[model samples]
Target: MNNVDEDNALVNFEDDQADDLDTSLAVDRFRDAVLYGTDWTVRTLLQQIEQGNIDLSPDFQRRDAWSLRNKSRFIESVALQLPIPQIVLAERKEQRGTYIVLDGKQRLLTLAQFAGDFPDDHPLWDESRKVASLRLSGLRVLTDLNGKTYNDFTSLPDLAQMRTQFDNHTIRSALIRNWPDEDYLYEVFIRLNTGSVRLSPQELRQAMKPGPFTAFLSIKSAESVTIQKILGLSAPDFRMRDVDLLLRLIAFSTRLSVYRGNLKQFLDETHEFYNANWGVEQKGMEGLLKRLEDGLIFLCAAFGNERHVGRRYKGDNFESPLNRAVLDVQIASALDENVRRAVEEGRLDLLGTFQKMSINDQEFAQAVAGTTKSITAIRTRYNSWRAALEGVIGQPVQMPELPNG
Candidate 1:
């Protein structure tokens, strides 16, 4: 987190696995999308953004991660009349003529910030609520423009022509107006964003499905000290990987009965459902998060940090990076009142039992590694962990019955 090297060392559980099962269907679905290209001058685009015709979703606003230097360089490129990449936009189905940004968010935001006209409510703003003006720096070609801001150009007669050139610079944009549904639009967004800096699926989902539930996930993930410690993160992940793991916990713990093997679809459905019904479901979701936190804290106290959610197989010297499947079942089982009481009352040696199982259980080991998103793997890990806990607790530990598929 604070140390760049240590932060880079944290492992992602699903890095090797495919997010979704079917790709041919997605390709077939997108074939019908109606897309057209247009060029918009910087002046016109800024006007649209100011008039609220262009929608920068809350998630996109949160991910304005470019530094001031980066923004200034981009402005320098515009000043030099360098070619810029095209942006992609999808028309909002609910509000005609208004469009949501699917790509080039940083570019657009940089333009607004450099022009000293970015919205004050935008997440990029500091606590002072003042619009940040970008001063050009690190310009190789336009070296004389360094330290100059848009306001400086307005005030200085010599810089007036340079400001006009920047305003008249046109950037190409591909607009999709007739998408069948949000799903198709999300696919388009994902495809458009496959550049040098690729977005994680959860990041895309956050942008596409912004609502109370998504906000809850982000806030809770950031606030949870236990989760941050377990994951070895000093701060919230830039790509929202921490949020992705928390979503897995919430989905499996609350909606296991409806899971049908596809982790991506299941998580997406959970987001959509909770977002749509957050008014009534907020309290229940809050309870779930509290239970998860309690479970995590108990595990840390009992087993210490290294072995909290890390996986170790037979003959292994060190624990593997935090395993999503292991975390899911362990935390879910710990949420049971009986299991917690048994462990706290000294009737059960939870750590010893877990270590024995980790060293000897093949089914459990396989379920936590390799391909873990399938129905068989999920059920195996949950049921196996529940059985292990039940044997130690001397009582039945309740778990949701997953689908047979």
Candidate 2:
């Protein structure tokens, strides 16, 4: 990826102020959680996984991040009766006994894959396939166990005792039940996962709000050549930043009037509602996606594909990294029916108008850069672009009314 693509892939416009809320309130909310400690033997945990009592949500970030060597080392640790970090699970309220793995997913998955008992239809099945009946490697102590799989132990009497020890090895687990709500659970998940191997906000969003709408975002993002070109992404972004941009476009275009400056909450609510009612709202969502794609295609054709969403000042020889704020206003304005027709009819110089504003307009520049997540900044970009387009398009340009807050 070029610098532009790399920058866009890491863009996150959510207001940091949202994260600065009262810590005392947050701590109080977490106090409502009911948790208990227990231990599960390797065989029992794998059995739970096989029986569908434990859910390793497919949308989990870095579900298969562990390498074969790392997995082997973990298995070796279990065989040696070494202490392992406790896993955290949340009991599903809807399905009493069933639980969702909140942390230590890779560890549990490693255990199952090495035992050659991982379910083929599992969420991590594709990654697990590469290490099924995983042969031990990179052993520091029991070097003799190298190159041997779990199945090998069954036929080799010398390794039979080791196999038994592995199966009986108990792992400590913290099971959380009777949470206040999914919101609370989501907070818990965020707190738990924000350690050394942290998940990005988009990753957490996708994992916390899995459903048809989430699936739709992934599929549409992968399929849209126009989106890929405009974002300079040759493939879907692993960090899900591409999807985050798409979500922003959808939310601002369709529900801008409802936005109240909390970008994260706004996006989260949108995901929750649409995911819950996807069957009824699928068609409308698809139409919104198509509109955004059409706007993107037009921008790409008017400006070079690589320069369309990038920022360029009057004196700058090269376009700056993709400006997400520029992306927002440009796409939103391009979606207007009158604006599109004007450009198509050779009446409006869309590219020239965009260049003039980007190079000369101080307020617009700041709106797209500094304090971008603020409601005022968001409104400034849209209103400023609307005025600029109207000046050239020779007519009023419609834009969504933003909230005062």
Best prediction by lDDT: 1
Q: Which candidate wins on TM-score?
A: 1
Error of 2 at 48 (Å): 2.7
For candidate 2, lDDT tens digit of each residue in 1-405?
122244453433332323412122366566777899999999999888777787654443222456678878898899999999999888877788888777787787777677737557666564445543778899998899999998887889999999899999999999998887656665666677454433345655775677899978877876776766665666665555567768878888778888776666788888888899898999988888888888888888777655555454444443544556677788887888989999889998887888788788889877866457778888888888999999887898888777676
lDDT value, candidate 2, whole model: 0.73
Please give each candidate's TM-score.
0.82, 0.73
**Among all windows of ten consecutive residues in candidate 1, which has the lowest summed lDDT?**
1-10
- Model 1 stretches astray by more than 4 angstroms: 1-12, 21-23, 26-28, 116-132, 135-146, 192-198, 225-233, 300-303, 306-322, 338-355, 392-395
Residue-pair clashes, model 1: 0
| 304-392 per-residue lDDT for model 1 (tens digits) | 65345655445545354667777787777778889888888999887788888877789988887777887888888888888888877
